[model samples]
Structures are given as structure tokens and as C-alpha cells.
Target: MTSPSDAPEGTEPGTEPGTEPGTEPGTVRPGGRTARVRAAVLEAAGDMLAEQGFHGLDLAEVARRAEVGKTTVYRRWGTVAGLVADLLTDMAEQSLPRAETGSLEGDLLANARLVRRTLSDPRQGPLFRAVIAAATGDARTAEALHRFYEVRVAEWAPCVREAVERGELPAGTDAAEVVRAVSAPLYYRLLTTDAPLDEDAARRAAAAAVAAARAGAFVRTP
Candidate 1:
């Protein structure tokens, strides 16, 4: 299993794949001081998730890491699971808009590339594994994990459905399933093996998914 890194830096959950936060205006806009505090808290939570695993996560510890008041952490996030759920929301909001690469192949590749980039990060990959392991034990964590992936898949599924509408793919294609296909192998690699989740693998997965979907893999056959 990939372990979370301590003080290891990678892309922020809310930022674009290649771009950092604060570089793009509409990418993320913290509304007020409280929102900023919440962001800091979530970052600290992410760090904790990667390094300590969820069972070891403490709101007070997160507050200390974020340099915020313990009361503030409790007030905002309520509990460790609550805090993690909110952090998942923050991560969803920060992910970049779906790529509009025109062709289904291009769009799928874009989606795969983005997933690979994020999950392959030095910090993020391990943190994800830790949280996933936590999810197996904690119902709340499992729900949060489900929501995180659901949001991500939804963000990218439109491209596939749009392709079908445009006649690039068969009608009645399962957009969400198509999107999942692109990342399924990457996750399998991340979970089952010690192989690096590399760019080539991401591209190949995307290509295969797009090709398979075009062949009606997601179509409802009579």
C-alpha cells in the first residue's frame, strides 16, 4: 500500500493538474477569512491523511498542524470524519474543469492523464491509498471516498456522453462507465502492484477505453 508522505508537497486538491493554485483566478476563490481557515484546515487534514492514516487523525492535531484554534476545527468540521468529508468536498471543487478535447479519444486521454498526474504525485498517491484503507474500516470514510470518486467521474463523464450525442459514439452509451474505464486500470495498478502509475499506462488505458466504448462496450445490446 502507498503510504502518505510527511511534509511531502504535490498538487493541491483544488488546483488544476499542471497549474498551481493562486495562478488561476477562477480556479479557486476563498470567500472570507473563515473559508481561508477551512482551506488551511483541509490541507492539514490531507497531510494527516497521508502521514498518519485516518484512524490516527485527530482534530486537535489537525488544528495544531494548521495553526488554528481547536475550537475552530471542531466548530467547522465537527469530527474527524466530518473534517475528512469536508476535505473531500474541497478536493472536488478544486479539480479542473473537464477537458474539451473534441474527440472521444482526446477527451478520454485527457481524463486519464489528469488522474495519472494527480494519483501519481509523491504525496497524493500514498495519501489516497491510506484513506482508501481507512474507508475499508470506517463507513464515513468509505462514503467520503465514494463521493470523491463520484464527483471526479461526473466531472469527466460529460465528454463521453457528448461524444455519443455528436454521433462519435453509439447512442445510449453509459457515460459514467466509459469514464471509469479510463481510470480503472490505473487504480488497479495503484492498489494491486508496486508499479509506477506512469503516463504511458494512462494513455494506453484511455485509448483502450475509448476504443472499447466506441465498439459498444457501454451500449445496451438487445
Candidate 2:
């Protein structure tokens, strides 16, 4: 797995830097230097992304910002799509651990709030929009975007499954889809409307999703 600092530079089809934060259970390594480098690269990439958009980025400039060699950037990530893929992977690996609130409603609420916060972030939202635009023209960029969401959904699926097991939700609920539902509106707000992504929105989304799950909206049809 790539570290935070190892994110490549570019705004091309595959050029998005990412960071993998947090620990991997049962895996240990002396990672101090590596972690610092990864963090530096990701931060620099984000700064560039927010300041200049995707088209404004170049690998050489990223190397300059990262204080690494252009060759190093090229060797690690060959294409723009490769860089974005690494960035997406780093994001997945480093994102906060999923919440386990012991109830589907609580967990979904937590997820909604977190998603709102992320999409509403001043730095991240524009960067995301830039990437989304880029993805429209690049298949690899689109794939990376899909994987990013997939990882997030998978991380929260257990909470939905647990609810089903506890009879708080009907059996046969597609846990990942249930998890995704809570964030759909949050992203909708981020992308479509200028509506504030406040606590109220988060709570409402979560409550609605939980209600839907209980009503068997998530059950897989035979």
C-alpha cells in the first residue's frame, strides 16, 4: 500500500494525490520517515489541487513542491491516471475508521455527518469537483472515483449488517447500498445545491435511510 507522502503529482486523468491515514490492524512497521514523506506529498498535492485545479498541475511542479525528484515521481506513477489511482488508494487506506455506534441509526447518522463534513470542507470540495470533471473524460479517473466510494461504503457496511442481525432492520438488506444511501443526499447538496451541510441535514439523511431499511427498501429481490 502507498503511504501519504508517496502520492504522485498531476491533474491529468490519473493524477490525484491521496493519503492513507491510520493504522492497519495486525500490521507493524517502523514507518516514521515514510509516513512523513507521504504526508508531505499529499499535502502538497492537495494545496496544488485547491489552488490551481487539475489542469494547472504538472508532475515537475509536484516534485518541486514535494522536494523530490521528477524522475522519482515519474517512476512511481507512470501516468496521470496512475497517480490518481494512488491518491484514491491512499485516501481509502488513511480515512478514519468506521464508527460502530451499536445501532444502525446511530452508525448511519455518524456516517452522514462525516460525509457532509468532508464534502463541505473548503479545501476538499473544490478539489473533488475538479476531479469529478476530469473523470468525465478519463475512464481511469472514473474508475478511481468509483473505488474511492466503494471503499467508504464497504467500511460502513458492517454496521448495516449488524442492524439486520439485531432485527432493527429486515434481513437481506444490501448493507453497502444502505450505507451509500445515507451519503447520497450529502453529495447531492455538495454537487447540486448551495445548501448548508449542517447537523440537521446529516440527522435527517440518517433517519430517512434507517427508516427505509426498516421498511425493506434495501432488501435484495429474488
Candidate 3:
């Protein structure tokens, strides 16, 4: 959600990024000039969110910062919520894929460390805090945030499934819950405490989740 570059010239304006010429906007396949515009606009939006928060996000300012036409921004993104939602979508799409470390503990630790790094990053951390704060009072932003996490959680769920297959965890372990468990304490610490998210913290979170899953804490009961 944090990086964006300038849009190149010579493409049709106002078309959504990554949309095909003959297709509807949301049908969305990536290419060409529109992607550049999207990149620029999203970058501007992210910067603004990090600097000024959701209340400070202005479409005109975003358009000016991105060097994109104001009309194009209005036409494509419509509202602040829409723009923020797209930013989340882009972030999810740009995020790293799941780690395949061949063991539940390794994969969960990787997941924990990734969360720590992201939540600890200067730009990303503030951006997340702003979005999360905005989401508390905004339904659209909340939905977008939920979707973003859903995508991420789904990406890592397989590690728990694999652990179950290997009999390292009980049968019917709730894979998503196990994955969430690995990250929950980290987020709680991020929001509730002033402690450092060191590697040791990541390791501890992963270890605790693994222990819990092995104890059937995350097993689905009928």
C-alpha cells in the first residue's frame, strides 16, 4: 500500500487500471498506461494517508500529487472510501505470497515475522493505523480491511492444513484460526503496547500458536 510511481503518457485517461479495452472496468487484467496512473494515484493516496490520515485524504490533492487529471480520479474512484478500498486491493495484490517452508512451525514463524515487519514499518505501520482507525467508523473501509485480511489469511491457511496432514496438529484444526492465532498477539501488541516487535517476539508468537494447535485449541468441534 505504500509504493507508487508516476504514470506514463500516451494511454487513454479515465479507464481503470489493469482493465482491458473491450471489457468492463472491474473485469481487470493488468497492462499499459492505466496501470501507471493507478500506481501514481495509489502512491499519492498512501502517502497522504500516512501523513495526514483518512481525514486529510482529498481527491483533488491526490490528483494533483499524482499528476493525474482530477476528473479521472473522480470518475474512477468516485469517493474516498472507494479510493481507499482500491488501495487495499492493490496492496493485497502486491503483497508477498505464502511461505512454503515445508513445516507448520517454519511457515507460521515466517508468517509471524512478516506481520511483525509490516506492522513495524514506518510508512506501512502508520498507513495501517490510519486505515484501521478509519474503519472503526466507516463501513466501506471496514469491509475493505476485512477483505484485505481475508486474502492474507487464506494465503497462509495451507500451512496449518499441511500440519494436520503430517499429524503435527490434530485433525480438523481450523487452519485460518491457527494462522490468525500466530498473528493475533502481534497485532494486539502493536495496538496495545509500546514494546518492540523483535524477532524473538515473532518466534514466541509462532511457538505459542503451534503449541495451541497441537493441543487442539483450534480444532473444529461439531
Candidate 4:
């Protein structure tokens, strides 16, 4: 996934090009060699995370796998947590945009299906699980993960607002809440059971969110 790099076009904004201290995950993407290095490092890091979990992630190993110098990896991302946080930011930037299907049900169904596909993907599924598991104990990782979802929710919130305008949902239906509701069940299934995230499940998730939303279950409260 393409992440927002903290650098101007064709230049990395850090102590030494792509080194850390001032480099945040989302600012501007770097260009040329710096961009390639970042991409390679993150790609290698993701593969290792999917295969070895957080505890097994090593900066030296990541550098070796990415074919970059270990010193570069250490300088850019000082700690494992820092690297993971950047990885989450990259994922957020790479996520798909929300669907605009006109009807709430249609839109939510599309959302549910997208979640299903991502959560069920061979590579992404495990990667997400590993990151989520790591987030439970690491504060930085959790914050970065929150940012990822915030970006996605913000992207999809407009559909709920549009539905309100069309009278498909209540006037004050919590758009973000409704959007979250659409995916909650699918995520629950993914995390709790070995159930397949099939078309029927996606339909059910969308239908339930639509039903609850139409009934004002997601209305904002004090």
C-alpha cells in the first residue's frame, strides 16, 4: 500500500534523507531512491509481520530482506513499534475509497463485501490479525491503527449523509456509526469464528445496518 511519506517531492524530510526524528507516516510521498527504499523496507516488513508476528520482526532482518543497509532501517524507524505504526499509515493510504450506490442498502452491501474480501485475502488477513494483535499491547500501534480506520470511516461517511438527504435514513443517523455497524459483524465473524465471509454474510451485514439505521438505532446521543 502507498503511504503518505513525510517528505517533499523527490526529497525525504529527515535527519539524513530517509532517516527518522522528523519523518511521519503521512505528510507527502518521497520520490526517487528514497521512495524505492521506503517501499522495499515496508514490503519486507509486512511479509515478516505476516509470517513471524510482531515479536519476530527484526530491523536487521528486514533490511536484509529488503536489500537495504541495516543502518538505514534503524535510522528511519528506530523501534519495531515505530515501523509498525508507519506500516499502518501506509495501509490507510492504500485502502479503497467508499462506494456511492445511491441507496443505503446498496452502499452498505458494497462496503460489507469489500471488508469481506480484504479480511479473507490470503496475505492481508494474516497481516491484519498480526497487527491487531500487536495493537492490543502497544500504544503507538493502537493509535496508528485508529488513524487507519478513521481515514476509512471518513471516506465512507458521506454515503450515510446522502442517504439522510434521500430520506433513506433518519435525519440524525450517525453516519460513522452506521458505517462501522456495516462492518462490525463481518469483523466479528472473522475474529471469532472460522466462518467464511461469503456473499450471504455480506448481504446480512448490510441489511442489518440498513435496518438499524432506518430505525434510528445509530442516532447521535449526548
Candidate 5:
């Protein structure tokens, strides 16, 4: 008979490798062996996505690189789309919190800089491009991508709300829209041009969002 430790890479008798003991198979725990396996898998997935784009992402390859069992990867993520969805979810969870700069400008600038830095990062930049490209033709991937942005926007929307409370912007300002405005140009520039994402570009993006907000452009209609 096999011992618990010898059950398998993903199966430990009492607990699943990627999920908590006695919990649902797909439920993610915060830490422990499960978390470590998840981290390893995600890291491998991101690396592959960065190096060869979505088409090159293979579950077996990811398991091999992560030193986990292929069975584990398949059981946890199921498909390439599933893996990418989990990857995006992990990215959103691990992303930086909203900046608490006293003024709205300061907060927007910080948000803009963070976005620029992420898009300009060697690994992150390529990973994002690959995911975005993958989403273009895949409905599931597109939904996951949209959820990823929604999570990010929700994280920063509070800053805009605070600005409104401070009377920096008009009442009924759509905080989500304001946050989106700050990131839109940076993403556009990243996808549309070969230009460097310099500090100036970040500042400009933040300034433009603030200007628009102050001018009541993001105000919601009754």
C-alpha cells in the first residue's frame, strides 16, 4: 500500500496539492504546500507566456518546469484557458495596492507610474502582450482578461472616490471610469507605438485623467 506522502504529487491522501485539506478541489488556500505548488505553476506559466506567447503554453511543459506532476497541473487548471484564467487571478491578487497619496494628482500619478513600470518590465511586458493577443480570439480568455482589469480598476477606484470626497472632482463622478482613463493611454501607447514608456508619459497620462475628472468629463448622468 502507498503511504500518504507517496500518494502522488497532487494527491496526499488527506489534502489536494493545489487546494486545502477537506475543501473543494478548486478552492485555493492562502499558504502551505498548495500555495507553493500554485506559485511554482504560475511562475512557470508566466515565464512560458513571456518567452513564447500563449500558443507555446503547454500544461506538460509547465509541470515539468515547475517540477510538479503533469497530473497535478491538469487536475488544478484543466485547460490552457483555465490556467491562464488562474494566472490572471493570481496577478490581480499579487498586484500592488492603491497608493494613498494625500492629493488626487499624487494618487493618479502613482497609479500611472505603476502601470507604466509593469508594462515596461521585461517579463511582465511580454507576458501581458501574450495574454492580450490570446484574448483576441478566445472568448474565455477575453472574459478572464476583462475580469483582471476589473479587479485592478476596483483597487484604484477608491482613490477617485476619495478625491470626490475632498471636493477635487464633481459629485457623482464615475470612479471606475476615472481609473480607466488613467490606464487607457498607457496601454494604447504600449500596444500602438515603439516609443519608450518614460516617466513623462506616465505623468502625462495621470495629468490627462485628472484634467478630465476636474472638467467633469467622468461625471455620471442622472
Candidate 6:
């Protein structure tokens, strides 16, 4: 559960030393007291969600755990939904960049592996499950979760686009759909079964996605 502030240099957007608009209120700038406090609060919020799910999240508890003023948390994030939205935003910003492997299969394999890693990670797995469960009944949380997936899908869509350009996939392939295809089954397995997400599962996911893309299953209809 590494916070965005703790991410290595150049790994995440807006990590450099400067102000960036649309960041969480207290995190307008990076590498300062404000940024540190923001990181602490978000970390505490994530921990609470991972441990007790979103229904258990409390702003006062988060502030106490973060050792920051309760007023600051309330003022900055207003509500639990707002805080969870910012947490999902931070997670999206902190995600790894897409792989640039030459072939479509290789690139898809890399993408599948990344998804597998995140869904299989101890901290991230529980955190995602909690967020997803919360989203089921919370409109704001659902919107935030959708946005998070949109960002991730956009980040990886270029791989499928490149495959199309290289004639590895059918022309007019829907890149986003192809990328989502690689993750759909993995997520289903994660939510439904108690099976372990092994490398074999990742490879199969990638292979299926590649087969679909090559067969024009992802082609966009006019």
C-alpha cells in the first residue's frame, strides 16, 4: 500500500516538485508539509477501507490515525465519498505506465501480468474489493470507480492501437475493448471464486484477448 508520495521518481504523474491543479485540496503541491499530511490521511483512509470496508470509514478515525487535525480532514474532503474519490484518483495516478513490448501478444501479456499483480496483491486486493463493494450501493463511489477504470483502460489502449497499426489486429479495432477483455475474466475470477490468480491465468487472459482482437471481435462498428 505505497502512497503516491512514496512512489519512486517519474513513476507517477504530478510527483515532481510543483503545484498541480485538480489534485486533492491539501496536495496542490508536492514534497511539502501539506503534501505529507495529505499522504498520511489518504494512507489512513486506505487502511481503514482495506480492513473494515467503506461502511466502516470514519473521517475522525482517519484524522486520528493520520495524526492530523480532524477539521483539516473534514474541510479538505467534506465526506467519506469525497475522500474515497480522491483515494481512487491517487491510485490511478500512481499506476505503472503501459509496457511497450514489440508484439501484440507480448504487450498484452505485460498488461495481463500487471492486472494480475494488482488483483493478487494482499493490500491492493482487499482495498479494491472494499471499494468495489462500496460502489455497488454508492453512486459517487461508483462514478469514481468507473473513472479509475477509464484512466487505466486509456493508459493501455495504445498497445492495442499499435497492434492495429502493425497489422497484428484488425483495422478499426476498439483498443479500449481489447484492453478490457484482458482484464474482464481476471476480475470476474477475483470477485466470484476463491481461486488463486496464477501466472497461468494471466497468460490465458492475455492469449484470449489477443485471439479476440485478431479475430476482429473488438472491431468498432460504424
Report the number of the highest-lDDT candidate.
Answer: 5
lDDT of 2 by residue, 118-152 (tens): 77788877778777777888898798889888898
lDDT of 6 at 76: 64
Least accurate 10 contiguous residues by lDDT in model 2: 21-30
At residue 81, give the lDDT of candidate 5: 87
Ranking by lDDT: 5, 6, 3, 4, 1, 2
What is candidate 3's TM-score against the reference?
0.88
Model 1 worst lDDT run, 10 consecutive residues:
1-10
Candidate 1 ranges with C-alpha deviation above 4 Å = 1-31
lDDT of every predicted structure (CA atoms)? 0.80, 0.74, 0.86, 0.84, 0.89, 0.87
Per-residue CA lDDT of candidate 3, range 1-222, in tens? 111333224334444555434543222545667678888989999999999999999999999999998876876677898889889999999999999999988999999999999999989988998999999999989999999999999999988998899989998899999999998999889889899888999999999999999999999999
Q: How good is model 5 by TM-score? A: 0.90
The superposed Cα distance between candidate 6 and the true structure at residue 149, in angstroms, equals 1.0
Q: Model 2 segments beyond 4 Å from truth?
A: 1-37
Per model, state how many residue pairs clash.
2, 12, 0, 0, 0, 0
Question: What is the full ranking by TM-score, best candidate first?
Answer: 5, 4, 3, 6, 1, 2
RMSD, every candidate, angstroms: 10.8, 8.2, 5.4, 5.2, 3.1, 7.5
Candidate 4 local Cα displacement, residue 125, angstroms:
0.3
Shift of residue 126 alpha carbon in model 4, Å: 0.3
**Which of candidates 1 and 4 is the stronger one according to TM-score?**
4
lDDT of 3 at 109: 97
For residues 1-222, what per-residue lDDT tens digits would candidate 5 score against the true structure?
235766657666644544555553333654687788889999999999999999999999999999998877876777888889888989998999999989999999999999999999999999999999999988888988999999999999999999999999999999999999999999999999999999999999999999999999999998
- Per-model TM against the reference: 0.83, 0.81, 0.88, 0.89, 0.90, 0.87
lDDT for model 4, on a 0 to 1 scale?
0.84
